[model samples]
Target: MSSNNAIVLKKYIDPTEGYPKIGEHFGLEERPFNLEATKVDEEHPLLLRNIYTSIDPYIRIRMQNPKYKSYLPSLGINQVIPNLTLAEVVKSAVPEHKTGSHVIFMSGWEEYTLVPKQAMGMVQSVNNPYNLPLMTFVGALGMPSQTAYIGLKHIGQPKAGETIYVSAASGAVGQVVGQLAKAMGLYVVGSAGSDEKIAHLKEIGYDAVFNYKKESVHEALPRVCPKGIDIYFENVGGETLDAVLLNANFHARIIFCGCISQYNNPNPYGLKNYSQILTKSIKVEGFIVMNLMPLYQEEYFREMPKLIAEGKLKYKYDVYMGLGSIPEGFLAVLQGNNFGKALSKIADE
Candidate 1:
């Protein structure tokens, strides 16, 4: 039997509210590995070796009980923490299964997972005909891609020749929105926290990018986006969103993807420019990508990969090695310290 090393939540503590480091709430351990003498049967379980697990700020939202319940299930304390994971099949007991095939499911941050046939619905068979990096499935062509596509094509109802601005533009979701907007014939501008990220955003086709840490968003927007923003892909809310509201064009569209800057703050992230939203006749709408996936799942799967293959899109990742790094890696991404999507590799494929 293969050993299962897992990342277990020690307790359900909001890492953003009081605790600065989330590692204190998580621990790694070797879980039960023993198997039945002859467990194989007509309908059997599938054992998978976890390859890369995505670490994002949204993981912090799951660290709550009923009082702070989200649409997603809460993490169970003293048990394995599960998120979007890419894995390879190592052992299969079912006749229809093929050993060594790759699949993705909402699995744990563990070395191995034994998934029963009843749980097959949660798994998705990955198609790698283009043989792009497997990480692409979890980052670009996955949830982040869907979130960006839906925000622009549907919610924003964007048109060409307009200017769109993205906050936290270097993160997983923001980068895709910027690239897609550029491909859609819009003038795309974005802001990141550092000079290097600003450069990366420009490299990925952002017409202009500013280091928000160096210059205040309110002061920089007018210079970078002289034409006025027609669409605002909101990622960092508090101060940045306030600035966008004041600078946005009349009838501008705002896609409320997330408020990562306010996620860990103990105090409420207040706003001072919401009046601009009304005065400018702006439209602000919030959406959960999960709810929109079914409507455009086929389109996303086809378009995103095609964009990547034709060199129309680019994605980045910050890979961490081994189980021990999970705590810090997860923390790094949540705090906006990572340059790209955070992923932890448990084993080589």
Candidate 2:
């Protein structure tokens, strides 16, 4: 009805610098977009009212200045940050499209979006036959589970009866990965940042979970996974990676997901046991969810939602209310303060 508010980057975060202070890196801007005044057409695009957006550690990578090349475009100064969002079509030009239809699309961390028809490949109409929460479209059933599905299948290549270790196992992606591993008949062990997260992971089918903050990863991994890690679902890099390497079985597979521990560092902590990969014949590989989504997304939505709705799959995320909560929510995610996947809710209904 009125002008919109969007979170904009105030400055490029240099890798040489530390984590941004609260309210220093991003600012909310009131844009001149008024749905009441604007014309709508193919070029003008359909206006979407954003409902929920996925806030992840990868968003931290987008904050960095382009001192080096990255797969994702770095957020530009004064530009609205972009994320995978679940939104409602408030206005549309298409004759077949109806107002209030929900679609999952990339939205500029704002109240509303103008997604053109050309971007249909990136947007999909919401098909929720199970009456599940829409936020799952942004969290578990969305990028997080998609990442877990692809990375575990393609990268880890896990086999039944093998032991798997997951770092940050209570986060959005890790939870899915761990649960999937359990379903495949693998013994699942994971490390979390807090006792509460560890408890959640255990309840969700993690055979073993430890608080890595209280106990060192090197100590915990060996104790929890005495069989040795055959598939390492890597999320927390740095010392955790080294610990995995130390405790990994011969020919173990390491699925390199995000390294949240080192996201803010200019110079990341280098692994000391570099030769372990060669010695153990380990397969260490990295994947970006964006690159693999096209191939696996259909499979993800087809199966994951049914499992989640049936209570066969467990997932977790924290949604901060309102557009105003974006900054604090994002910062909490970056600092590992969020219990689960952190997201911002704009207008769910």
Candidate 3:
């Protein structure tokens, strides 16, 4: 057995101070660890070599102290920060999980991981029946896609002929939400920070898209959706939320998926148009995708892949190579530097 490389938290990050610098809070190191050594019982242990690891903005919340408490647990100091990862079972004591089986699981930012059979329930098999890239399991066909599906169907409840507005439109979850809205016959508009991302959204069939950095969300929403937005898939909060409230139609649905804008800001922006929620009888709800997992897992797996195969759904990947790239990838995602779903290619498939 050999030592594996991983990204370990060097110190607790202060969210109020702003974005993290690579080496100051996180560092990569090699540790003496092996899969077989972690087996609880020889009968059903699995050793996984991670291939792809996702880097999401929400992970920043976990970097904060436990006192800041979020729905998800915070990462401990000097521990390997875990994220959704796609791994190949290199060795397995279980009959059902064979060596070479690709599985997606909650694992650390490490080259390899060991899990007992009891924890196997968290491991999802990557069954790519459509021959799509295996990386899709970490993006479109993975949690982000599920987040989009559940939020839209269960929360946003969009209908055909309705107008849907998505902030962070080119991001992992936002991209899917826009595409799904379009497929369901709703008018869709998206907002991204850069011209490149805006163009990508348009090419993928968004009814309209704007470079939010160049144009105000207040101005863009009405220009794209004159009738007012019926569904606001809220990804970036703060000013965007304020604008959405101003343009929201009566009984509008706001699926609050994330708030990247306020994640790092100590003094987060306050919404002035919140009064519209009451005046318009709007439904504004915040959700974490994990809570809806059991209810939507079966349906999500059944439909999302089919949509991807049928060409009704599309996704993009912003991939960083190697485990050492984890910090860079994470920072890029927080800063909205990467387009689409951000991931790190930990190893070759």
Candidate 4:
């Protein structure tokens, strides 16, 4: 038996209380985990050494009580906090999964994990022709890209020469949404938190970009998008959303991807300009990417990689090193401290 170090949930979070401080809700610990000792003949298992893990906003919603349920299950207190991870299979009892093979699955915030055979179906092999970095499987080519594709193509339904506004434009999903909209010949404007992010958006071909922290979205939107927006990719909800509603064009579409701004707020701001939805005949749809996976996963896998390879799509990552960095990395993402997709690099590829 060897000691396994893992980050465990220390307590259930109160969503109304806002973002958690380090060590307040999560902490690291070491425990003995013997794969051989715990073997049951009916169960198939694999030992995994995690290489990279994603720190996403949705995980925050799961940290709260079960009564505040989500599409996913809540994290159990004192248990290892599971995340979408890329790992190498070090040992396996199942014939289908071979040793030394790399796999992607939901694993804990640990140096190593013992995954059951029931979860094998959820595990995906990273072997592909794209020649992209493995970490991208958890970022761009993974949920974020899928999210962008499904929302924009299905809900937003953007048209050529139309205007699209994206909030939290530098985030993993927002960046992809903006790029995809532009590829469809729509004029795209993005709002980010800082000057650096604003510049990055322009470098990647956003028609216009603004710093939401400095400029009021209400004022800046009218100047940048003179024609009013045809599609608004809503990522940061609060005031930014209200401003978009005020300026939305007739028959505009609003895809409610996330509400990062209100995620931690005790009392989230209500939409004052919601009346515009009725007047403009706006189609406001809130969606979870998983709900549309069966319909769009194949299309996403085929098109997104080609777009990235052709240089039509661009992505950025704010990677923190080591397993110990997971807490701070998660906190950084929630606080807008990270510039792009937030990830923790547990080991070298």
The candidate scoring highest on lDDT is: 3
Off by over 4 Å in 2: 117-120
Q: Residue 347 in model 4: shift from native, Å?
A: 1.8
Report the Cα lDDT for candidate 4. 0.86
**Model 2 Cα lDDT, one tens digit per residue, 51-73:** 89877777777887877578988
User: Which candidate achieves the best TM-score against the true structure?
Assistant: 2
Which digits, one per residue and each the tens of the lDDT, describe model 3 over residues 1-349?
7678889887777779798778888879888875456653464478889999988888888888788778987788888889899999888877777888999998869998878667788888778888877888887887888899999999987789999999999999989998888889999999999999988999888998899999888778889988899999998899999999999999999999998998889898977999999999999999999999889888898888888888778789999998988898899999889888999899898
Model 1 CA deviation exceeding 4 Å by range: 19-23, 35-44
Clash number for candidate 1:
0
Q: Name the weakest run of 10 consecutive residues (lDDT summed) in model 3.
A: 35-44
Clashes of 4: 0
lDDT of 4 by residue, 1-349 (tens): 8667788888888789899767878877778877556552335477788999888888888888889868888888888888889998887787776888888888858888777668778877776687877888887887777888999999888889999999989988989988888889999999999999999999888999899889899999999999999999999899998999989999999999999888799998988999999999999999998899889877788888888877778899999898888898889989999988888898777
Q: What is the C-alpha RMSD of each candidate to the true structure, in Å?
A: 2.0, 1.5, 1.8, 1.7
lDDT of 1 by residue, 212-326 (tens): 9899998999999999999999987888988898889999999999988877777757899889988999999999998989898888787778888877888888888997788
True-structure lDDT of candidate 3: 0.87
How many clashes would you count in candidate 2?
A: 0
Q: Tell me the TM-score of model 1.
A: 0.94
By TM-score, is 1 or 2 better? 2
